[model samples]
Target: MVEKWLVALQVILAAIGVYQFTLSLFGIYRKKKHKEYEPKKTFAVLVAAHNEEAVIDALMENLKTVDYPKDMYDVFVICDNCTDNTADIVREHGWTACERHNPHQRGKGFAIEWMLKKLWEMPRQFDAVVMLDADNLVSPDFLREMNNDLCSGARVIQGYIDTKNPHDSWITAAYGVTYWYCNRLWQLSRTNLKMANFLGGTGMCFENQLLKDMGWGATSLVEDLEFTVRCVKNGVNPVFNYKARVYDEKPLTFKASARQRLRWMQGHFTVARRYFFPLLWQSLKERNLAKFDTALYTITVYTVLVTFLLTGYMWVDAALFNGPNFPTLYEYLPTWLAVVSVVATCAAFILALILEGVKSWRVYASLITFPIFLLSWWPITFYAFFTQNNKVWSHTEHTRVVRLDEVHGKQVS
Candidate 1:
């Protein structure tokens, strides 16, 4: 009975993995419609920070260098629960600053909510709002690309994210690979299918009215995912803008990223509990594929959890008690089947890297260690089970202040 159950469970997990992978490949069929955009829409660029004095000036300077009229867009910084001079620097740079010191209410979500209310009360109105991380650097044409998409009837938009510190460590390089895979595999495919795109934590733009209508009070540790679930329910999906690039600082150490990943996993599960069944039920009733896809995406972490558990069980059961006398993975699943799974995964990574124009030896070399990075998610996900109610988060520190070209090893300009 144990052997039969293990085989059946493995089959189910295999099918789920294959389904998700195949679905991600829909980007290969995506058709792009391009147009020249007049940068007419005024923007309110928002930066959320806790203790980012080291990097705020660079972000502010980068914003000033954006290839758009200086008067057309205004920058706003929310210094939420900061002990450093993060707000003072924003003021020094002549940007709008909202300094919130409420010890009880923390996290980016609360900070954004407070700032939004304050902004709406002011006389000046922004056509759209773009949320950026305090540690991020933007492309010169980032706003222009967003304006084009906004004018073309996209109310929500997310930009492409590249690591500003990819070469700093193997961990950051692995993050680059993971994001490269995500950029095409997830966002592009969803756009091609006319489905909802997940709101990236940073580098996302939204029409002010859409945000107001949704009552944007997403306070989860993973506010982006929470906002995404709410947005999909209200029929507002983010559109992908590949040219609108945002350079984010990936965690260089495993400890920093592990905490971040666990928080993300916890938030994902929270959102899934709140939205998945409703989405699944709605899809069944209204026959909405978009909702179904979003639900499918949400539950994948759970599937991953099951896969890990079952793999461990099978390994132990085979080595200790099974009659097949230490059966190899190929004994449970056919050799050809295992080979196909690995080949498909490799093919996806190759396509993503090639499409993203990555030729770095560092990035290629890190691929050998990327599986270890992926494996770490298992433990992180396990910890996520106990952290569903975490309200506060530790901020990932960033101190890299070099020009984009320096970190990227090529002249970006």
Candidate 2:
């Protein structure tokens, strides 16, 4: 019975690993053709800020350099429960500043829903709405690429999330490497395979019609992910636009990054509970492969915990029931296979850096220790399982204030 159970568990882990590896391979060879569409869609760029006085000014100034037409997009900053001068800075840039003092509803989801209602109340109706963080610098061609996606019939689009402070610290470098890998492997692969792309909190855009139809009702800890699941269930999968880039400031310290990820893992648990079954049911009822894919993707965060527990149990079982005929747990997985897996994964990370045009030698060196960062997720996952019900929003503080020119040393067109 123990041997049989071990085989089943190994098969499950192998399947997950193989599925992800296949996707990464798909991402590597896929080349998407870019088409320029006439800028016809009016946009309401919404920036959610909570006392982001340090970075809001830089973001506001960066928006001024966006290559899109002045009349095409309007910027609005939502200063939620901010005692700082976040609102004042937005007004200084001649952008509309919306101040909300609701301590009860403090997360980005509530702020977004509130802002959507505010936008509807006004006379100006937008064709689409772009969501962004206060601690971000938009690429010059951000809106233009989004416009191309919208015009090309993508209802919900996610932009490539780049790190603004990749070299500031090892934590940020890990984040930079991770985001670059995901952009190519996860997001781009899903797009190439015609599957749904999950939305990062920032750098997402939704059509006004879809927003009105679905409404910004996601108030979970990771509203972006919850909303993505909702969109998938509704038969409206979000697509990835690689050209639409948004540079986000990463958490400088490991502790800050861990806390932020803890909240995210907690939110993942919440969303999985709420939508996993529904997504599965939808896929079965409609025979939709996309919905099924989304369902599978939803539970992937728990993969680390599941694999850990199963392997640990197998090891203990092997120790207790050792015999000459019974092979140890380590014997089940060939050493060469494990070595190849690690090498292939490291090669992929290096490929991501080259493709993303990251030149810093230090950033490349950080990849050697990136596995430590990935391993850190184990404890976070365990803790999140116990505290998943605690939905308190813990915001990561952003202090690196860099201009658009400073990000890439040249404007992104």
Check candidate 1 and list the clashing pairs: none
lDDT of 2 at 73: 94
Off by over 4 Å in 2: 1-3, 30-32, 311-334, 409-413
Candidate 1: clashing residue pairs, number: 0
Q: Model 1, range 159-246, lDDT digits (tens) per residue?
A: 9887788878889888888888898888888888788888889999999888878777798888988888777777777788877899
Each model's TM-score, in the order given?
0.94, 0.93
What are the root-mean-square deviations of the candidates from the true structure over C-alphas?
2.5, 2.8
Question: lDDT scores for all predictions?
Answer: 0.83, 0.87
C-alpha lDDT of residue 213 in model 2: 90
Model 2: per-residue Cα lDDT over 333-391, one tens digit each:
77888888878878888897787777788888787778899889988988899999996
Q: List the residue pairs that clash in candidate 2.
A: none
Model 1's alpha-carbon lDDT is: 0.83
